[model samples]
Target: MGMMDTLDEWHSIYIKAGIALPGALLSARFRDEGSDEQKMGLLLATALACLLACAAAQNNNPTENLALRGRATQSSTYYNYVFGYLASAINAIDGNMDSNFYHGSCSFTNNDMSPWWRVDLLKSHKISQIVVTNRGDCCGNLIDGAQILVGDSLENNGNNNPSCSEINYLPNGGTQTFECNGMAGRYVNIIIPGKETYLTLCEVQVFGVPVSKKPPCS
Candidate 1:
């Protein structure tokens, strides 16, 4: 049987043995009179309960967007003259996934060589996935070939960090998820290399757990 099945079987056994009682009550009830089997069963049940609780506590949900708790910046901001809107980097982390740039929810960088955007998670995390939302109104293809990088170093504005994934293509108004497979880092960067072009993103979502919370290397 699989690990989960084994755990389920143990859980059922724990419940059937009536060993799920309060710790103090169980200790008092079996203090001096219970058979050795009963005492051992109680000890095993307690251990199992603790194991389950620890497992649940360590379970990291890859869907939780850790970017929302961080700060963001880009190489340069795009200014809309008529609308008087500045496409700031913080727009991407504002939790608004509206892909229309005109809606003022997307972040845009000025046309520049190797324009980059980054989010500082403030602490190291074992990043498992990243989701990028492409602009729908226009210029969606500009995001193609962008590199997703993760690391703790600030060298070259974090563009030099280890790459997580490269975007081959993301359609207009479409959201794409990239798996990083637990790359440890404090900074998540997105940059378009080898071109003088605008970089726009409606949303950048990062999923992971803090490094301190991760189990130690075996």
Candidate 2:
């Protein structure tokens, strides 16, 4: 489905769950004439509203690291001459927290503008928190300014999804937790916006509950 369609689904879910969401306002901004900047602002506001609703739901539900059960991919893979494709995207979700890059337990992307990595949870979920582990060997600062986005759309490689939070700074080899406040989405994305740099993630753990039990991506 298209981005707007995906957003409509989110709006319906929130409305059905009895959460107050400005769905009409959101639709108007998208469907009516508006500047790109204004639309972008509205989009972020709508995403935040979804997140707040999800956060309320999280109060009564238990969550786990859903990323372990999901499929992972990245913008590009980093190939090591000696280790081959040791920096593959799947490493971050392998349930291992090894921070050393040489240990073959981290996902690394080729140095590129707006590098990103994503995980598909197989079904929509009300995400509560996302934990990211940075590489300890070196270059942890490169992850600074990275964004945590959650949504069902694959548009712009999921980078255009609503953002849960931004990493100002994460200490080397440090594992940081980002609260999504219950943003509902089937996909979670990590992207460094507006700069050319490597994206390395030692581990990415997502916690949440399924929004529905239905089969996805059919």
Candidate 3:
């Protein structure tokens, strides 16, 4: 019921999860000095502040997935289902690469010629890499010949964007990561050239730092 009690509860959970409590979070010295309400409040606040700072550090880590925040649009939806296998699934940022139908819109497309899927970062970025996932279930071959394209252009529906990587054929329920070497772009697209096909994608992730005059991720 007290601040220390709460901290101890979280500490136990973290230990069980294989995380060690930081020294600052222990704060046994501060506790020994006083039981003052204000002091305990301040300690709790400081721990929270430190936790938030740790989170920010993790956000800046290159390994963090950056696609969850972008906006996605596809050439066609299986139907116009708002949450249906629309273009949005590619950037749902779920990191689910399974082919299970219960995976619920892991990826699918409207039957169309040259179907395309794209994500708008809404700001220019120095893209580092793009990761593509194939459906695990039947017909996972739908992603064959997919091109990873990046640029600021809307010309030809961004199909004219420069290619970062071309997917030859991703194995069923497989994932491929392509390094773009810091290509600058506000748009990232995936397309299978010269084909009337189903562009099924379990997920697509883009990692990058926003293009800015100041420090991009700071």
Candidate 4:
């Protein structure tokens, strides 16, 4: 039989034997002992209460799922900009990318000189929307242009890559939201091509949805 079945059988035999065993031992010691039924009833109640207590304890012990949380911006400490595949959560709805189990891996930058950041998507991803959030108030990078490079290449040799094509443009500040035209690309490059103010960045959010040519039907 199963272990549970054996336990149940043993418990049944114990309960049966307990009816007379406790009272018989007590009667041997005392002249007139308490009733066996009362002793058996008390033991059964205690056993039931202990089983319920164990069940309650198991229920109270719950496991919490761990995930990433954003850092508080109000703090005075400064954090440098960062952007990579591991930085931002992959939120492509077309089954093209994977979700980021952690948060805030992607970010923008503000460099006064030849300010630019390169992101190698490695493979072509049809991206349509990008949401940018400043890491702190009065802290943001001047984003003059956004481009995407198609195919396999990572030119960190200080050579301005020719294959990179501009996908979005912002001549001045107030550029937190960028809705791309559903551009397909492998490598994405953001150009801070101007001598803007002190650069600051918080987070960069890339969202991908299916590109639809036809307008909404009435």
Q: Give the candidates in order of lDDT, highest first.
A: 2, 1, 3, 4
Q: Which stretches of candidate 1 lie over 4 Å from their true place?
A: 1-42, 53-60, 214-218
lDDT of 4 by residue, 18-119 (tens): 322234232333223447775555456545544544443323321210111111111011233453322222221112221121233223332335444444
Give me the displacement of residue 78 in model 4, in angstroms: 9.1
- 50-106 in candidate 1: lDDT tens per residue? 555445445545556899999999999999999999999999999999999999999
TM-score winner between 1 and 4, please give it.
1
Q: Please, what is the whole-model Cα lDDT of each candidate in the order they appear?
A: 0.84, 0.85, 0.72, 0.35
Tell me each candidate's TM-score.
0.79, 0.70, 0.65, 0.34
Candidate closer to the true structure by TM-score (higher is better), 2 or 3: 2
Tens-digit lDDT track of model 3 for 1-218:
66567667666655533456667567554444565875666566556654654454334424646667777777876644564534344533566655564457565677789988888888888888898877777777888888999999989889998999899888888888898988889999899889999887778888887777232123
lDDT of candidate 3 vs native?
Answer: 0.72
Question: What is candidate 2's CA lDDT for residue 4?
Answer: 65
lDDT of 2 at 20: 67
Q: Write the residue-wise lDDT of candidate 2 on 1-218 in tens digits.
A: 54466667767766644566674555563455578876687678677767766665545434468999999999999989986656889999999998999999999999889999999999999888899999999998989999999999999999999999999999889998888877999999999999999999999999988876332111
TM-score of predicted structure 2: 0.70
- Pick by TM-score: 1 or 2, better one: 1
Candidate 3 — worst ten consecutive residues by lDDT sum? 83-92
Candidate 2: residue 141 Cα off by (Å)? 0.5
Off by over 4 Å in 3: 1-61, 80-92, 213-218
